[model samples]
Target: MSRERVSFTELTDVSQKYWPEASVGVSLIAPAIYRLHEYLNRLARELFKQYNLQSAEFETLCALRNSPEPYRITPTELYRKLLVSSGGMTKILLRLEDKELIERPANLADARSRLVALTPKGKSLIEKVTAQLIEQEAELVARIDQPGQLEQHLLRWLAQIESHQDDKGPHL
Candidate 1:
């Protein structure tokens, strides 16, 4: 199926009319970034739904899958890695446990914390879902004429933004 191509002309026009003091690049880049985020999020949500997983749940599984042998990590570590709150991580872990996709066992090192690990079923499901997501992402990026070049540019842009995160004043 064909879709209408996105363009920045309207953004530029509106910026010029209502916010002439701002750089036109701001209008172009911000909306493009937001739209790109929305599009990718929509695709990810669809993929997660197909696998009976929420985005957070999938992320938690991935974190476990990437960990050392036995594929286990502490709840605090998982929350930190996923940039989520402890309470939220606890809820996600509880849901996955109920679904028999994950387990929470008392931590030997820290009695105050618990270790999270994938069940056999969780491992199987994550493997399948991750493979499908990789395929979908490959297909999506393949649409671009120079996917590698696009990736490099995006990475550089992101790095620049991240490097300036600690600055007290706006660097953009």
Candidate 2:
């Protein structure tokens, strides 16, 4: 026997009976994006756990690894790059320092600011973990393929959205 298909409207009506007060104005895009974000976070958390690391630690390592010449960054710089609050960055740095995974050095630029850099041991560990993480990430993306192309398309979409930011502000 063939089953009859239920349209979205039918599902919405059925949902109201069970949900009672759920707004019908909900859009699929928001929920789908949220689910995708959660899925990626879970996968990342699992992968990082294999190295005894977290996403925040991995990001800090990458930042240090990518730094030019001196291979160091200030807490303020790290905070800006990671989009984390100052207090949160300080806690992260403290944790990494406790692990001896990174070092805090006197900043030549300004005495008030301290510079953060990977220790020799930290560098070795980051190199090892990063190699494994890269392979894992590649595998994850391979399931979908053309991740670079997808990233480019997403970048374009994001740029378009960002372009409209000023439109909401008051005109001069």
Candidate 3:
């Protein structure tokens, strides 16, 4: 799983030599974006490993961390927000509770399900991890000049794509 990927240069070279009729720059756009996405995922996995956490576990913590004050949400809410199955969310919640990173308190609104909230330790740890993640991401982008402009371009591109998805109807 530690194999290196083919470079963008190689991809461009193939497009130019084998498919001369196509616009090489335009043709390579999606592949380039996909490669970057893969690299970012790998980077996040490595960072999470350093904290002895699985990516899903970190995501669960983050969902709670980013929630409204009191930092609590029902298991159903967590599963929906994290786009995980209810069973998967249950496993993640159990692991986090075992780690003492979160606590489940009785939900006054409903007796059937408990509210998941960050413990004092969980809150502090998440804040520290979030800061580190920001620092690491900033360092990755610092190599490029005009990073802010690049961000704006990406934001616009994302918005356009999302709008097209809207036209296609609801996501599954």
* Positional deviation of residue 132's Cα in model 2 after best superposition, in angstroms: 2.3
User: How many clashes show up per model?
Assistant: 0, 0, 0
Candidate 2 is scored at a TM of: 0.71
In candidate 1, where is summed lDDT lowest over 10 consecutive residues?
Answer: 23-32
Tens digits of per-residue lDDT for model 3, 18-82:
98778634656677788888888888888888887898988898999999989999999899999
Model 2 clash count equals 0
Estimated TM-score per prediction?
0.82, 0.71, 0.86
Clashing residue pairs, candidate 3? none
Clashing pairs in 2: none
Write one digit per residue (lDDT tens) for candidate 2, span 48-124. Answer: 78877878888888888888846798888888989889998888888889989899999988999789998987788
After superposition, candidate 3 runs with Cα above 4 Å error: 1-3, 18-25, 170-172
